[model samples]
Target: MTSSHRKGSTEGTNRVRDGGAVHVSPLELDITWGGDGRYWRIDQDRRIAELIQVCWLEVNGSVEMHHLQPNTRYKLEFKIRLKPDAFGWNDSPVYIMAMPGKGTKCIWASADLSKIRKGEQTCSIPSRLEFTTPSSSVADDKMSFGLFEIWKGRWKGGLVIEEVVISKV
Candidate 1:
């Protein structure tokens, strides 16, 4: 993957668009939603759950940050949800991995996603989050990090995700 580092602004920020193909920030890794099973959504039980068709595609991108002080960790959080009236996470953690110096495989560092307790159909909560990025000391070549939907150790249930954020650890 390629990266473009910009001057200033170490704090991770987001830019929102209305429609069409996505736009990427000059300094951030561009993660695209090409050919992921996410497009095939499961229908919610109409009698018990509210049928919500998400207008926004949600946050989509990569964790390849340029200008990161070599070895320093960058943490990211993605807030999500499953059902409208649902409250609780899948009891699973998010998995994060980094590839040092343009490697094909990602070195694993996990980001555990918390539960969804608060109500905010139009807002994001920290509980329902995928926590990634750690204060690391493995910087040698350009590093890249990201979280995965599936974790290795446990079984997952429920839904997680509402919004996303990126920052330094």
Candidate 2:
């Protein structure tokens, strides 16, 4: 797959750190759901970008974006709320499968972050997620990119997501 990138001070790719040195935004997201309420604006929360100091969202609901890199290598670190025992706020959240409509897939997944860290290049893996890029994750002939279009249940009273980060390999 080609390394599709957008250059500019875009909403989720800008990072000015340590006296104006701009670093590439290695992480991005469309956080439609989480512990906090959904916010359409980028300046509202940190759950939006788990790493690389980019855009973040701290809420719960639905979010959608397009032009995701297709049939390629990628990495995502997410701290998702797991299925709490009989709790309404429980969230063993599964990232909304970014299938043909989004041109992507999920290859691997693990709620454990330590394992994901073995190959991650930047940022620490979150202890709350299991992610993958395999096409057979949910259904055949499909792929899952960490776009987070859907979240199971709600983050009514707990920390929605501790962190989330993603990169195209």
lDDT of 2 at 9: 29
The residue-by-residue lDDT of candidate 1 on 45-143, one tens digit each, is 320112122212222244333434344444444444455444223454455444534534555544333544534443333422223233443343344
Candidate RMSDs in Å, in order, are 11.5, 12.3
Clash pairs, candidate 1, are 31-61, 71-139, 79-161, 79-162, 79-163, 80-160, 80-161, 80-162, 81-161, 90-157
Alpha-carbon runs more than 4 Å astray in model 1: 1-60, 81-83, 86-93, 100-114, 121-143, 150-164
Q: What is the lDDT of residue 93 in candidate 1?
A: 46
* Best-fitting candidate, scored by lDDT: 1
Summed over model 2, clashes come to: 29
> Mind giving the per-residue lDDT tens digits that candidate 2 earns over 42-67?
32344222221112212221112222
Listed in order, each prediction's TM-score against the native is 0.37, 0.31
True-structure lDDT of candidate 1: 0.36
- How much is 160 displaced in model 1, in angstroms? 6.3
Cα deviation at 150, candidate 1, in Å, is 4.3
